[model samples]
Target: MKLTQIDKVYGKKHVLKNVTLEFPAGKITVMVGPSGSGKSTILRSLNLLVTPESGQYDFNGHQIDFSQKLSSKEKLAIRRETGMVFQDYNLFPHKTVLNNVIEGPTQVLKMGRKQASELARELLAKVGMADYGDVYPNELSGGQAQRVAIARALAMKPQYLLLDEPTSALDPELELSVLKVLLQLAHEKQSMVLITHNMAFAKQIADKIVFIEEGQVIYDGGPEEFFSADNPNGRIKNFIASMTMENLR
Candidate 1:
């Protein structure tokens, strides 16, 4: 995916200012920054949840013309290719875990109920939640809830996945569980744009890292180039130092 000269504004404040970056296909790209740095906003704009005021989004070699108005059908087409996972597990309270995973496939994609159930079971197993399909979201820990959310996102067979702070809500032990599942996905060659503070995880799993500050990308490079102390970008160095301190504490 490529973002060219992208610009977004909220009321009077400019959130994304002419940002341009290219995300290689079929690679894990992690976005890291301090809080309120617009990392999530950049992800949201890619799926059109937050429309850009100006600029273009290109996906799979097709340039998304944000300048022209999109029809409902066009919007749905883009959404079908992208899936988003939020920090909060947005599962339906009344639905069982199995049902929560299958609901979108059955309702949105019009898959047969039986087929959706089979797919749901397969995805649940993939996320290490095969035994919890019958359980309710409230019965699971925060990490489990997030795993179920991941299963739900994968059910749509999205070409790209957007994750916003996937482990921030979990305890240390639970955070590892969630991170493990993400690492598994990366190994399976899933293309993802992840917004996270876990520098260690990023270094291990991300093929590329994009550092954002004040709604613009300040550094974009491979893990080696980014983590090197000799790097000249002060913002990148300081951000890495802050994350390291947070992890140490």
Candidate 2:
């Protein structure tokens, strides 16, 4: 997926400024930055959840001019190729885990119930949630619920998975559990675009890193240089130091 010169605004506040980036197939691209730096907007824009005000979005040669309003059919087509997992698990409270996972396939994809359930079960096992199929979202730990969320996304057979701080609400132990699941997916070559503040996790999983600040791309490069002490940007170095200190505390 590619975005060129994308710009977005809410009222008078410019949320994204001429943002251009690429998400390579079968590689993990991590977006790391301070809070309110437009990382979420960038992630949401990939699925057309947040409509940009200008520029182009190209997904597999389907070019979208953001200045023009997107038809529902266009949005659905983009979304069909991508699945988003948010910081909150956002599971259906009244649905069983199996039901929650199957909803998208049955409703959106129009797969038969039996076929959707079979696919859902396989994805649930893939994400280490096989035993939780009968469980409700409220009954599980944050980590388990997040895993179920992952399974639900996977069940949709998305070509690209977009995650926005999927583990941010968990404790350290629970966070690691969710991170482990993501690491496994990365090993399996699932194309992913993730927005995260955990610098260490980003380094461990990123093939490319896009550091955003003030609604602009501060740096777009590999993790080795982005995490190195020799980084030339003073503000970025300071940001790293501050994040490190926060982790320590």
Candidate 3:
């Protein structure tokens, strides 16, 4: 998926500014920046959860210009190809964990309930939630709900998985569990675009790194060069240092 010259605004706040980015297939592209720097906006744009007010979005061979309105089918087509995992673990409060994971496959993809249940259980097991399938979101801890959310997203079999801080809310122990799942996914070469404040974790999994600052792509390149000590861009180096320092504290 690729975005070219995208611009997004919310009321008076200009969140994304002429941002252009690309997520190569089978690679983990980690997006990092300060809060409200449009990292989340850019990630959501890939799944069309947040549409740009202008410019273009391209997925596979399909190109969508901001000027052209999209029908429900078109929107669903794009969204189906990309699954988004929100930071808040947006599970249905009324639904059990198993039902939450199976809802998409059964309702949207039209898979049979038995098949969907099988798939959901498989994904739940993958995310270390095999035993919690019958539980509700409220009954689970933050990490458990997040893992269930990951399982729910995976159940769709999306080509590209978009995650917004999958571990930001969890305590260190809980965070480690989610990180292990993500690391396993990364090892399998899943096509992922993640927005994370965890610099150390980002460095471990990123194949490509995009640094956004004040709603602009400050840098877009490999993790090595961006994280190098000799990286000439002081701003880039300082941002990493600042984030690292914050993490230390």
Candidate 4:
């Protein structure tokens, strides 16, 4: 996906300002920034969850005209191609883990119940939660809940996955489990735009790192370039320092 001159605002507050970047297809790209820096806003805009005031978003060779209003059906179609995994595991409280994973395909995509169940089982196994299919979200730990959320998103077979701080809510041991799943997905070449504070994971899995500050991208480059002290951008250095402190803490 390619974004150009993207702008977004809430009343008088501009959350994103004329941001431009390209996400390489079939590769993991991580976006890092402090809170309220527009990192999540950028991801939400791609799926039209947050409409941009002005911008061009091109996906798979089709340019999205922000100025033109799309019908509900059209917007749903775009969202179907992009699945978002939220920081909070947004599972239905009444649904079992298996049902949560299968709900989207069976409802939205109109897949047969049996087919959806089979697919859900496969994805649950992929995320190392095969045995928890019958459990409810509340019965699982935060990491396991997030794994089910990932499986739920994958049920739609999205071309692009947007992950917002996938590990933020987990304990350290649980965080490792979730990150391991993500690393496996990265190796499988899933196209993803991840908003993360984990610099180590970004360095290991991301093809490119985009650093946003106060609604603007201050640095976009390979992980090597981003970590090198020879880089002249003070903003990047400061960002790295903050990230390091967060990790150390």
Best by lDDT: 2
| Clashes per candidate (backbone, < 3 Å) | 0, 0, 0, 0
What TM-score would you give candidate 4 relative to the actual structure?
Answer: 0.96
lDDT of 2 by residue, 72-162 (tens): 9999999988989999999999999999999999999999999999999999888888998898899999999999999999888999999
Q: Sort the predicted structures by lDDT, highest score first.
A: 2, 3, 4, 1
Superposed model 4: Cα runs more than 4 Å off: 246-249
Global lDDT of each model? 0.89, 0.93, 0.91, 0.90
Q: Is candidate 3 or candidate 4 better by lDDT?
A: 3
Q: How far is candidate 1 from the true structure (C-alpha RMSD, Å)?
A: 1.6
The top-ranked prediction according to TM-score is 2
In candidate 3 the C-alpha lDDT for residue 218 amounts to 92
Stronger candidate by lDDT (2 vs 3) = 2
TM-scores of the models, in the given order?
0.96, 0.97, 0.96, 0.96
The stretch of ten residues in a row with the least summed lDDT in candidate 2 is 240-249
Residue 216 error, candidate 4, Å: 1.0
lDDT of 4 at 146: 95
TM-score, structure 1 vs. true = 0.96
lDDT of 4 at 109: 96
lDDT, candidate 3, 1-249, per-residue tens: 889999999999898899888899999999999998999989888888888899898897778998678777878998888989988999999999999999999999999999999999999999999999889899999989999998899888989999999899889899888888988998998899999988899999999999998899999999999999999999988899898894366
Predictions: Cα RMSD each: 1.6, 1.4, 1.5, 1.6
On residues 113-185, what C-alpha lDDT tens digit does candidate 4 reach at each position? 9999999999999999999988988899999999999999999999999999989988889989999999999
Q: What is the lDDT for 37 in model 4?
A: 96
